[model samples]
Target: MPRNTLVNTGLNLLGLDYKPLTVTIAAMEADTHFGFEQVSPNEKEGRVMAVFSSVADKYDVMNDLMSGGMHRLWKFRMRQCSAVRQNHVVLDVAAGSGDIALGHLRKMGDTGRVILSDLNGPMLHEGARRMLDAGYLPGRADCIQADGSCLPFADAIMDCVSIAFGIRNFVAIEAGLAEFYRVLKPGGQFICLEFSRPVLPFLGVIYDTYSFHMIPQIGEWVTGDRDSYQYLVESIRRFPDQKRFSHLITQAGFDLVRHENMTGGIVALHRGYKL
Candidate 1:
Protein backbone atom coordinates (compact mmCIF):
# COMPACT_ATOMS: atom_id res chain seq x y z
CA MET A 1 0.00 0.00 0.00
CA PRO A 2 1.09 3.58 -0.61
CA ARG A 3 2.31 5.57 2.42
CA ASN A 4 -0.38 8.22 1.86
CA THR A 5 -3.06 5.52 1.68
CA LEU A 6 -1.89 4.22 5.07
CA VAL A 7 -2.01 7.76 6.49
CA ASN A 8 -5.56 8.28 5.31
CA THR A 9 -6.62 4.94 6.77
CA GLY A 10 -5.10 5.85 10.10
CA LEU A 11 -7.09 9.06 10.15
CA ASN A 12 -10.31 7.18 9.51
CA LEU A 13 -9.60 4.45 12.05
CA LEU A 14 -8.80 6.98 14.73
CA GLY A 15 -11.89 9.04 13.89
CA LEU A 16 -9.67 12.06 13.35
CA ASP A 17 -9.38 14.69 10.65
CA TYR A 18 -6.46 15.25 8.26
CA LYS A 19 -3.81 15.13 10.98
CA PRO A 20 -1.50 12.16 10.38
CA LEU A 21 -1.76 9.44 13.01
CA THR A 22 1.40 7.65 12.03
CA VAL A 23 1.43 5.59 15.22
CA THR A 24 -1.73 3.70 14.18
CA ILE A 25 -0.99 3.49 10.48
CA ALA A 26 0.87 0.18 10.63
CA ALA A 27 -1.88 -1.49 12.65
CA MET A 28 -4.74 0.00 10.62
CA GLU A 29 -3.38 -1.10 7.25
CA ALA A 30 -4.09 -4.77 7.83
CA ASP A 31 -6.16 -5.98 4.86
CA THR A 32 -9.81 -6.77 5.43
CA HIS A 33 -12.11 -9.02 3.40
CA PHE A 34 -14.06 -7.56 0.51
CA GLY A 35 -16.10 -10.53 -0.61
CA PHE A 36 -13.56 -13.29 -1.13
CA GLU A 37 -10.83 -10.80 -1.92
CA GLN A 38 -8.45 -9.16 0.55
CA VAL A 39 -8.52 -5.37 0.44
CA SER A 40 -7.46 -2.43 2.54
CA PRO A 41 -10.11 -1.39 5.09
CA ASN A 42 -10.40 1.97 3.37
CA GLU A 43 -10.71 0.34 -0.03
CA LYS A 44 -13.36 -2.16 1.06
CA GLU A 45 -15.86 0.60 1.93
CA GLY A 46 -15.59 2.19 -1.52
CA ARG A 47 -15.75 -1.22 -3.21
CA VAL A 48 -18.91 -2.18 -1.34
CA MET A 49 -20.44 1.22 -2.05
CA ALA A 50 -19.68 0.84 -5.76
CA VAL A 51 -21.30 -2.57 -5.80
CA PHE A 52 -24.51 -1.33 -4.13
CA SER A 53 -24.58 1.87 -6.19
CA SER A 54 -24.34 -0.16 -9.38
CA VAL A 55 -27.35 -2.23 -8.37
CA ALA A 56 -29.42 0.24 -6.32
CA ASP A 57 -32.30 0.51 -8.81
CA LYS A 58 -32.35 -3.21 -9.48
CA TYR A 59 -31.67 -4.40 -5.91
CA ASP A 60 -35.27 -5.29 -5.15
CA VAL A 61 -35.74 -7.12 -8.44
CA MET A 62 -32.55 -9.09 -7.97
CA ASN A 63 -33.58 -10.02 -4.43
CA ASP A 64 -36.83 -11.44 -5.79
CA LEU A 65 -35.09 -13.23 -8.60
CA MET A 66 -32.34 -14.74 -6.46
CA SER A 67 -34.48 -15.75 -3.50
CA GLY A 68 -37.64 -16.64 -5.41
CA GLY A 69 -39.51 -13.98 -3.44
CA MET A 70 -38.75 -15.68 -0.14
CA HIS A 71 -36.82 -12.59 0.90
CA ARG A 72 -40.14 -10.95 1.68
CA LEU A 73 -41.20 -13.82 3.93
CA TRP A 74 -37.82 -13.77 5.66
CA LYS A 75 -38.21 -10.03 6.32
CA PHE A 76 -41.72 -10.65 7.62
CA ARG A 77 -40.24 -13.07 10.11
CA MET A 78 -37.71 -10.39 11.00
CA ARG A 79 -40.51 -7.92 11.77
CA GLN A 80 -42.37 -10.52 13.79
CA CYS A 81 -39.28 -10.89 15.94
CA SER A 82 -38.64 -7.14 16.04
CA ALA A 83 -41.79 -6.62 18.13
CA VAL A 84 -41.71 -2.85 17.80
CA ARG A 85 -44.47 -1.11 19.71
CA GLN A 86 -46.18 2.24 19.27
CA ASN A 87 -44.06 5.34 20.05
CA HIS A 88 -40.81 3.45 19.68
CA VAL A 89 -37.87 4.66 17.60
CA VAL A 90 -36.07 2.33 15.19
CA LEU A 91 -32.74 2.80 13.48
CA ASP A 92 -32.31 0.47 10.53
CA VAL A 93 -28.68 0.47 9.40
CA ALA A 94 -27.51 -0.14 5.87
CA ALA A 95 -31.23 -0.25 5.20
CA GLY A 96 -31.14 -0.92 1.41
CA SER A 97 -34.40 0.01 -0.36
CA GLY A 98 -36.29 0.31 2.99
CA ASP A 99 -38.28 -2.93 2.77
CA ILE A 100 -37.58 -3.59 6.44
CA ALA A 101 -38.09 0.05 7.36
CA LEU A 102 -41.45 0.20 5.55
CA GLY A 103 -42.57 -2.93 7.33
CA HIS A 104 -41.80 -1.36 10.68
CA LEU A 105 -43.50 1.92 9.81
CA ARG A 106 -46.77 0.12 9.00
CA LYS A 107 -46.69 -1.78 12.28
CA MET A 108 -45.13 0.85 14.59
CA GLY A 109 -48.31 2.94 14.53
CA ASP A 110 -48.52 6.64 13.56
CA THR A 111 -46.53 7.82 16.56
CA GLY A 112 -43.60 5.48 16.03
CA ARG A 113 -40.69 6.42 13.74
CA VAL A 114 -37.99 4.64 11.75
CA ILE A 115 -34.69 5.98 10.48
CA LEU A 116 -33.40 4.37 7.30
CA SER A 117 -29.65 4.67 6.85
CA ASP A 118 -27.22 3.49 4.16
CA LEU A 119 -23.63 4.27 3.23
CA ASN A 120 -24.38 4.45 -0.46
CA GLY A 121 -26.24 7.65 -1.32
CA PRO A 122 -28.08 6.05 -4.23
CA MET A 123 -29.25 3.16 -2.08
CA LEU A 124 -30.42 5.56 0.62
CA HIS A 125 -32.25 7.68 -1.94
CA GLU A 126 -33.96 4.63 -3.43
CA GLY A 127 -35.04 3.50 0.01
CA ALA A 128 -36.42 6.91 0.91
CA ARG A 129 -38.32 7.12 -2.38
CA ARG A 130 -39.88 3.70 -1.90
CA MET A 131 -40.98 4.57 1.62
CA LEU A 132 -42.77 7.65 0.29
CA ASP A 133 -44.35 5.64 -2.53
CA ALA A 134 -45.69 3.19 0.05
CA GLY A 135 -47.71 6.06 1.57
CA TYR A 136 -45.49 6.56 4.60
CA LEU A 137 -45.22 10.13 5.81
CA PRO A 138 -41.84 11.85 5.63
CA GLY A 139 -41.89 12.52 9.36
CA ARG A 140 -42.65 8.86 10.09
CA ALA A 141 -39.43 7.78 8.40
CA ASP A 142 -36.10 9.60 8.17
CA CYS A 143 -33.37 8.66 5.71
CA ILE A 144 -29.73 9.35 6.52
CA GLN A 145 -26.49 8.62 4.75
CA ALA A 146 -24.53 6.92 7.53
CA ASP A 147 -21.99 4.26 8.26
CA GLY A 148 -22.72 1.34 10.53
CA SER A 149 -19.31 1.37 12.17
CA CYS A 150 -19.78 4.87 13.56
CA LEU A 151 -23.33 6.10 13.62
CA PRO A 152 -24.07 9.81 14.05
CA PHE A 153 -26.87 9.19 16.56
CA ALA A 154 -26.62 9.61 20.29
CA ASP A 155 -26.18 6.71 22.68
CA ALA A 156 -28.95 4.48 24.09
CA ILE A 157 -31.78 6.22 22.25
CA MET A 158 -33.16 3.79 19.70
CA ASP A 159 -35.83 1.36 20.82
CA CYS A 160 -34.91 -1.09 18.06
CA VAL A 161 -31.88 -1.50 15.78
CA SER A 162 -31.74 -3.55 12.62
CA ILE A 163 -29.71 -4.50 9.59
CA ALA A 164 -30.98 -6.64 6.70
CA PHE A 165 -28.77 -8.34 4.16
CA GLY A 166 -26.21 -5.59 4.74
CA ILE A 167 -23.95 -6.41 7.70
CA ARG A 168 -21.73 -8.74 5.73
CA ASN A 169 -20.58 -5.80 3.68
CA PHE A 170 -19.13 -4.03 6.73
CA VAL A 171 -15.34 -3.90 6.74
CA ALA A 172 -15.40 -3.91 10.55
CA ILE A 173 -18.18 -6.27 11.57
CA GLU A 174 -17.36 -6.11 15.28
CA ALA A 175 -17.22 -2.34 15.21
CA GLY A 176 -20.64 -2.16 13.60
CA LEU A 177 -22.08 -4.55 16.16
CA ALA A 178 -20.70 -2.40 18.96
CA GLU A 179 -22.25 0.66 17.37
CA PHE A 180 -25.61 -1.13 17.27
CA TYR A 181 -25.28 -1.98 20.91
CA ARG A 182 -24.25 1.57 21.72
CA VAL A 183 -27.23 3.14 19.96
CA LEU A 184 -29.97 0.90 21.37
CA LYS A 185 -31.92 1.77 24.50
CA PRO A 186 -31.87 -0.62 27.37
CA GLY A 187 -34.53 -3.29 26.65
CA GLY A 188 -34.33 -2.38 22.96
CA GLN A 189 -34.35 -5.08 20.30
CA PHE A 190 -31.68 -5.80 17.71
CA ILE A 191 -32.92 -7.71 14.71
CA CYS A 192 -30.66 -8.91 11.93
CA LEU A 193 -31.94 -10.64 8.82
CA GLU A 194 -29.16 -12.00 6.64
CA PHE A 195 -28.12 -14.84 4.38
CA SER A 196 -26.35 -17.63 6.19
CA ARG A 197 -24.75 -21.00 5.63
CA PRO A 198 -27.20 -23.75 4.75
CA VAL A 199 -27.80 -26.41 7.38
CA LEU A 200 -28.63 -29.21 4.99
CA PRO A 201 -25.60 -30.44 3.12
CA PHE A 202 -27.67 -31.09 0.02
CA LEU A 203 -29.17 -27.63 0.20
CA GLY A 204 -25.68 -26.21 0.42
CA VAL A 205 -24.74 -28.06 -2.71
CA ILE A 206 -27.71 -26.68 -4.64
CA TYR A 207 -27.26 -23.18 -3.23
CA ASP A 208 -23.56 -23.07 -4.04
CA THR A 209 -24.20 -24.26 -7.57
CA TYR A 210 -26.87 -21.62 -8.12
CA SER A 211 -25.03 -18.80 -6.36
CA PHE A 212 -21.66 -19.43 -8.00
CA HIS A 213 -23.07 -20.05 -11.44
CA MET A 214 -26.47 -18.52 -11.99
CA ILE A 215 -26.67 -15.42 -9.73
CA PRO A 216 -23.84 -13.57 -11.43
CA GLN A 217 -25.18 -14.49 -14.86
CA ILE A 218 -28.60 -13.25 -13.80
CA GLY A 219 -27.01 -10.03 -12.55
CA GLU A 220 -25.24 -9.48 -15.83
CA TRP A 221 -28.49 -9.90 -17.71
CA VAL A 222 -30.45 -7.65 -15.33
CA THR A 223 -28.12 -4.95 -13.99
CA GLY A 224 -25.19 -5.23 -16.40
CA ASP A 225 -22.97 -5.87 -13.37
CA ARG A 226 -21.84 -9.44 -12.91
CA ASP A 227 -18.82 -8.70 -10.74
CA SER A 228 -20.92 -6.91 -8.12
CA TYR A 229 -23.25 -9.88 -7.75
CA GLN A 230 -20.26 -12.21 -7.70
CA TYR A 231 -18.86 -10.25 -4.75
CA LEU A 232 -22.23 -10.26 -2.96
CA VAL A 233 -22.55 -14.04 -3.24
CA GLU A 234 -19.03 -14.47 -1.97
CA SER A 235 -19.74 -12.11 0.95
CA ILE A 236 -22.51 -14.37 2.28
CA ARG A 237 -20.02 -17.21 2.49
CA ARG A 238 -17.48 -15.01 4.26
CA PHE A 239 -19.91 -13.86 6.96
CA PRO A 240 -19.84 -15.74 10.23
CA ASP A 241 -22.40 -18.53 10.56
CA GLN A 242 -25.47 -18.42 12.85
CA LYS A 243 -23.84 -19.51 16.08
CA ARG A 244 -20.77 -17.39 15.58
CA PHE A 245 -22.90 -14.36 14.81
CA SER A 246 -25.08 -14.96 17.85
CA HIS A 247 -21.95 -15.00 19.95
CA LEU A 248 -20.93 -11.72 18.39
CA ILE A 249 -24.24 -10.17 19.38
CA THR A 250 -23.78 -11.43 22.91
CA GLN A 251 -20.30 -9.97 23.03
CA ALA A 252 -21.77 -6.65 21.97
CA GLY A 253 -23.56 -6.49 25.35
CA PHE A 254 -26.91 -7.93 24.31
CA ASP A 255 -28.87 -10.48 26.31
CA LEU A 256 -31.07 -13.36 25.14
CA VAL A 257 -29.49 -13.43 21.71
CA ARG A 258 -30.86 -16.20 19.48
CA HIS A 259 -31.21 -16.93 15.79
CA GLU A 260 -33.93 -18.59 13.76
CA ASN A 261 -32.84 -20.10 10.48
CA MET A 262 -35.19 -19.88 7.50
CA THR A 263 -35.13 -21.81 4.24
CA GLY A 264 -33.00 -24.60 5.64
CA GLY A 265 -30.60 -22.02 7.07
CA ILE A 266 -30.03 -20.15 3.81
CA VAL A 267 -31.31 -17.11 5.74
CA ALA A 268 -31.20 -16.42 9.47
CA LEU A 269 -32.96 -13.89 11.68
CA HIS A 270 -30.96 -13.16 14.80
CA ARG A 271 -32.65 -11.22 17.57
CA GLY A 272 -31.10 -9.77 20.71
CA TYR A 273 -32.16 -7.49 23.53
CA LYS A 274 -30.25 -4.72 25.25
CA LEU A 275 -30.94 -5.25 28.93
Candidate 2:
Protein backbone atom coordinates (compact mmCIF):
# COMPACT_ATOMS: atom_id res chain seq x y z
CA MET A 1 0.00 0.00 0.00
CA PRO A 2 1.16 3.52 -0.79
CA ARG A 3 0.60 6.52 1.41
CA ASN A 4 -1.35 9.24 -0.35
CA THR A 5 0.54 12.48 0.19
CA LEU A 6 -1.75 14.89 -1.65
CA VAL A 7 -4.90 16.53 -0.39
CA ASN A 8 -7.41 18.79 -2.14
CA THR A 9 -9.26 21.49 -0.25
CA GLY A 10 -11.88 23.78 -1.75
CA LEU A 11 -14.01 26.05 0.37
CA ASN A 12 -15.87 29.27 -0.36
CA LEU A 13 -14.43 31.18 2.57
CA LEU A 14 -14.36 34.87 3.57
CA GLY A 15 -17.21 35.46 1.11
CA LEU A 16 -14.50 35.51 -1.54
CA ASP A 17 -15.37 32.19 -3.18
CA TYR A 18 -11.83 31.11 -2.50
CA LYS A 19 -10.36 27.64 -2.87
CA PRO A 20 -7.02 26.65 -1.40
CA LEU A 21 -4.53 24.14 -2.71
CA THR A 22 -2.83 22.19 0.06
CA VAL A 23 -0.04 19.73 -0.70
CA THR A 24 1.05 17.74 2.32
CA ILE A 25 4.13 15.56 2.27
CA ALA A 26 4.08 13.19 5.22
CA ALA A 27 7.67 12.83 6.29
CA MET A 28 7.92 10.42 9.23
CA GLU A 29 11.40 11.40 10.37
CA ALA A 30 9.88 12.97 13.52
CA ASP A 31 6.37 12.80 14.89
CA THR A 32 4.10 15.31 16.69
CA HIS A 33 0.54 15.62 17.88
CA PHE A 34 -2.43 16.59 15.76
CA GLY A 35 -4.79 16.16 18.63
CA PHE A 36 -4.01 12.70 20.08
CA GLU A 37 -2.94 11.19 16.81
CA GLN A 38 0.74 11.19 15.89
CA VAL A 39 1.73 13.03 12.73
CA SER A 40 4.98 14.03 11.17
CA PRO A 41 6.28 17.53 11.73
CA ASN A 42 5.75 18.31 8.06
CA GLU A 43 2.09 17.35 8.33
CA LYS A 44 1.22 19.12 11.58
CA GLU A 45 1.44 22.70 10.37
CA GLY A 46 -0.76 22.11 7.32
CA ARG A 47 -3.34 20.33 9.46
CA VAL A 48 -3.30 23.08 12.08
CA MET A 49 -3.64 25.69 9.40
CA ALA A 50 -6.62 23.87 7.99
CA VAL A 51 -8.24 23.76 11.39
CA PHE A 52 -7.87 27.49 11.99
CA SER A 53 -8.97 28.35 8.48
CA SER A 54 -12.16 26.44 9.02
CA VAL A 55 -12.95 28.17 12.29
CA ALA A 56 -11.54 31.68 11.77
CA ASP A 57 -14.94 33.31 11.15
CA LYS A 58 -16.66 31.69 14.14
CA TYR A 59 -13.68 31.48 16.48
CA ASP A 60 -14.76 34.24 18.86
CA VAL A 61 -18.39 33.19 18.96
CA MET A 62 -17.48 29.60 19.65
CA ASN A 63 -15.09 30.65 22.40
CA ASP A 64 -17.89 32.51 24.14
CA LEU A 65 -20.23 29.60 23.77
CA MET A 66 -17.68 27.10 24.99
CA SER A 67 -16.55 29.09 28.03
CA GLY A 68 -19.86 30.79 28.86
CA GLY A 69 -18.05 34.15 28.61
CA MET A 70 -15.55 33.33 31.38
CA HIS A 71 -12.74 33.61 28.85
CA ARG A 72 -13.24 37.37 28.92
CA LEU A 73 -12.75 37.47 32.68
CA TRP A 74 -9.60 35.35 32.40
CA LYS A 75 -8.15 37.67 29.76
CA PHE A 76 -8.92 40.75 31.87
CA ARG A 77 -6.95 39.26 34.72
CA MET A 78 -4.05 38.52 32.39
CA ARG A 79 -4.01 42.10 31.17
CA GLN A 80 -4.05 43.41 34.73
CA CYS A 81 -1.06 41.19 35.57
CA SER A 82 0.81 42.37 32.48
CA ALA A 83 1.89 45.66 34.09
CA VAL A 84 2.11 47.35 30.74
CA ARG A 85 3.35 50.96 30.80
CA GLN A 86 3.77 53.78 28.34
CA ASN A 87 6.14 53.43 25.38
CA HIS A 88 6.18 49.67 25.59
CA VAL A 89 6.11 47.35 22.59
CA VAL A 90 4.24 44.10 23.17
CA LEU A 91 3.99 41.10 20.90
CA ASP A 92 0.94 38.88 21.24
CA VAL A 93 1.70 35.61 19.49
CA ALA A 94 -1.14 33.54 18.07
CA ALA A 95 -3.28 36.59 18.78
CA GLY A 96 -6.63 35.24 17.67
CA SER A 97 -9.11 38.10 17.15
CA GLY A 98 -6.70 40.45 18.98
CA ASP A 99 -8.12 40.05 22.50
CA ILE A 100 -4.81 40.14 24.37
CA ALA A 101 -3.39 42.91 22.21
CA LEU A 102 -6.51 45.00 22.69
CA GLY A 103 -6.42 44.50 26.44
CA HIS A 104 -2.74 45.46 26.56
CA LEU A 105 -3.50 48.55 24.50
CA ARG A 106 -6.14 49.66 27.00
CA LYS A 107 -3.61 49.23 29.77
CA MET A 108 -0.97 51.14 27.83
CA GLY A 109 -3.11 54.33 27.77
CA ASP A 110 -2.77 55.05 24.07
CA THR A 111 0.98 55.41 24.43
CA GLY A 112 2.36 52.00 23.41
CA ARG A 113 2.08 49.70 20.39
CA VAL A 114 1.37 46.02 19.82
CA ILE A 115 1.97 43.39 17.20
CA LEU A 116 -0.60 40.61 16.73
CA SER A 117 1.24 37.68 15.20
CA ASP A 118 -0.29 34.38 14.06
CA LEU A 119 0.75 31.69 11.65
CA ASN A 120 -2.60 31.26 9.95
CA GLY A 121 -3.33 34.13 7.58
CA PRO A 122 -7.08 33.89 8.01
CA MET A 123 -6.77 34.00 11.77
CA LEU A 124 -4.31 36.90 11.63
CA HIS A 125 -6.58 38.77 9.23
CA GLU A 126 -9.49 38.28 11.61
CA GLY A 127 -7.33 39.70 14.42
CA ALA A 128 -6.31 42.67 12.28
CA ARG A 129 -9.94 43.44 11.53
CA ARG A 130 -10.86 43.38 15.21
CA MET A 131 -7.98 45.75 15.99
CA LEU A 132 -9.17 48.24 13.37
CA ASP A 133 -12.77 47.94 14.54
CA ALA A 134 -11.65 48.76 18.09
CA GLY A 135 -10.26 52.06 16.75
CA TYR A 136 -6.67 51.12 17.47
CA LEU A 137 -4.68 53.24 15.07
CA PRO A 138 -2.88 51.40 12.26
CA GLY A 139 0.42 52.60 13.68
CA ARG A 140 -0.44 51.08 17.05
CA ALA A 141 -1.54 47.59 16.05
CA ASP A 142 0.13 45.65 13.28
CA CYS A 143 -0.72 42.09 12.26
CA ILE A 144 1.93 39.68 11.01
CA GLN A 145 1.71 36.09 9.82
CA ALA A 146 4.62 34.39 11.54
CA ASP A 147 5.30 31.17 13.39
CA GLY A 148 5.62 31.55 17.15
CA SER A 149 8.75 29.37 17.23
CA CYS A 150 10.49 31.50 14.59
CA LEU A 151 9.69 35.17 15.06
CA PRO A 152 10.79 37.71 12.48
CA PHE A 153 11.72 40.57 14.78
CA ALA A 154 15.22 41.52 15.84
CA ASP A 155 16.44 40.37 19.27
CA ALA A 156 15.83 42.50 22.37
CA ILE A 157 13.23 44.64 20.61
CA MET A 158 10.07 43.90 22.55
CA ASP A 159 9.40 45.16 26.06
CA CYS A 160 6.80 42.42 26.62
CA VAL A 161 5.83 39.16 24.93
CA SER A 162 2.63 37.19 25.44
CA ILE A 163 0.68 34.25 24.15
CA ALA A 164 -2.73 33.03 25.29
CA PHE A 165 -4.07 29.53 24.70
CA GLY A 166 -1.73 29.47 21.73
CA ILE A 167 1.59 27.99 22.76
CA ARG A 168 0.04 24.56 23.28
CA ASN A 169 -0.55 24.27 19.56
CA PHE A 170 3.00 25.17 18.68
CA VAL A 171 4.82 22.22 17.10
CA ALA A 172 7.90 23.20 19.06
CA ILE A 173 6.78 24.95 22.23
CA GLU A 174 10.26 25.11 23.74
CA ALA A 175 11.53 26.79 20.59
CA GLY A 176 8.73 29.29 20.80
CA LEU A 177 9.59 30.09 24.42
CA ALA A 178 13.22 30.51 23.47
CA GLU A 179 12.14 32.89 20.73
CA PHE A 180 10.12 34.87 23.26
CA TYR A 181 13.15 35.01 25.50
CA ARG A 182 15.41 36.10 22.67
CA VAL A 183 13.13 38.91 21.55
CA LEU A 184 12.55 40.49 24.97
CA LYS A 185 14.66 43.34 26.31
CA PRO A 186 16.34 42.92 29.67
CA GLY A 187 13.76 43.13 32.44
CA GLY A 188 11.00 42.62 29.87
CA GLN A 189 7.97 40.58 30.81
CA PHE A 190 6.60 37.30 29.45
CA ILE A 191 3.06 36.20 30.12
CA CYS A 192 1.16 33.11 29.02
CA LEU A 193 -2.47 32.22 29.63
CA GLU A 194 -3.29 28.60 28.90
CA PHE A 195 -5.61 25.77 29.80
CA SER A 196 -4.30 23.53 32.55
CA ARG A 197 -5.27 20.71 34.82
CA PRO A 198 -8.14 21.42 37.18
CA VAL A 199 -7.16 21.46 40.86
CA LEU A 200 -9.89 19.47 42.55
CA PRO A 201 -10.68 15.91 41.57
CA PHE A 202 -14.37 16.60 40.99
CA LEU A 203 -13.58 19.65 38.88
CA GLY A 204 -11.13 17.70 36.76
CA VAL A 205 -13.73 15.05 36.07
CA ILE A 206 -16.33 17.62 35.07
CA TYR A 207 -13.89 19.54 32.92
CA ASP A 208 -12.77 16.46 31.05
CA THR A 209 -16.39 15.54 30.37
CA TYR A 210 -17.19 18.95 29.02
CA SER A 211 -13.95 19.29 27.07
CA PHE A 212 -14.08 15.88 25.40
CA HIS A 213 -17.82 15.60 24.81
CA MET A 214 -19.54 18.97 24.83
CA ILE A 215 -16.96 21.20 23.14
CA PRO A 216 -16.71 19.42 19.82
CA GLN A 217 -20.46 18.97 19.61
CA ILE A 218 -21.09 22.65 20.28
CA GLY A 219 -18.36 23.60 17.86
CA GLU A 220 -19.95 21.55 15.12
CA TRP A 221 -23.36 23.04 15.84
CA VAL A 222 -21.93 26.56 15.66
CA THR A 223 -19.08 26.44 13.16
CA GLY A 224 -19.87 23.39 11.00
CA ASP A 225 -16.36 22.17 11.82
CA ARG A 226 -16.27 19.45 14.42
CA ASP A 227 -12.80 18.08 13.74
CA SER A 228 -11.07 21.37 14.41
CA TYR A 229 -12.89 21.77 17.69
CA GLN A 230 -12.05 18.20 18.59
CA TYR A 231 -8.41 18.91 17.96
CA LEU A 232 -8.63 22.06 20.08
CA VAL A 233 -9.93 20.10 23.06
CA GLU A 234 -7.27 17.43 22.71
CA SER A 235 -4.54 20.02 22.39
CA ILE A 236 -5.51 21.39 25.79
CA ARG A 237 -5.07 17.95 27.27
CA ARG A 238 -1.72 17.52 25.53
CA PHE A 239 -0.40 20.80 26.93
CA PRO A 240 1.99 20.65 29.86
CA ASP A 241 0.53 21.08 33.31
CA GLN A 242 0.90 24.40 35.13
CA LYS A 243 3.92 23.56 37.28
CA ARG A 244 5.89 21.77 34.57
CA PHE A 245 5.23 24.60 32.12
CA SER A 246 6.39 27.17 34.66
CA HIS A 247 9.70 25.31 34.99
CA LEU A 248 10.08 25.22 31.21
CA ILE A 249 9.66 28.99 31.07
CA THR A 250 12.35 29.43 33.72
CA GLN A 251 14.71 27.29 31.65
CA ALA A 252 14.19 29.71 28.77
CA GLY A 253 16.05 32.36 30.82
CA PHE A 254 13.00 34.12 32.32
CA ASP A 255 13.55 35.10 35.95
CA LEU A 256 11.19 35.19 38.92
CA VAL A 257 8.74 32.95 37.16
CA ARG A 258 5.36 32.43 38.81
CA HIS A 259 1.91 31.17 37.89
CA GLU A 260 -1.58 31.86 39.25
CA ASN A 261 -4.41 29.47 38.58
CA MET A 262 -7.77 30.95 37.64
CA THR A 263 -11.17 29.22 37.44
CA GLY A 264 -9.96 26.44 39.68
CA GLY A 265 -6.83 25.77 37.68
CA ILE A 266 -8.62 25.04 34.42
CA VAL A 267 -6.64 28.05 33.25
CA ALA A 268 -3.39 29.46 34.61
CA LEU A 269 -1.57 32.73 34.13
CA HIS A 270 2.21 32.44 34.18
CA ARG A 271 4.40 35.52 34.42
CA GLY A 272 8.16 35.95 34.34
CA TYR A 273 10.77 38.55 33.44
CA LYS A 274 13.83 38.50 31.18
CA LEU A 275 15.85 40.02 33.99
Give per-model CA RMSD. 6.1, 8.0
Candidate 2 wrong stretches, greater than 4 Å: 1-29
Q: Give the whole-model CA lDDT for all candidates, comma-separated.
A: 0.82, 0.82
* Pairs with steric clashes in candidate 2: none
Any idea what lDDT model 1 has? 0.82
Instruction: Report the lDDT of model 2 for residue 28.
Output: 27
* Residue 195 displacement in candidate 1 (angstroms): 0.9
Give per-residue CA lDDT, model 1, range 120-160, as digits (tens).
88788888788778766456777766677767666778899
Candidate 1, TM-score vs. the true structure?
0.89
Per-prediction tally of clashes: 0, 0
Candidate 2 structure lDDT: 0.82
* Candidate 2: worst-modelled 10 consecutive residues by lDDT: 5-14
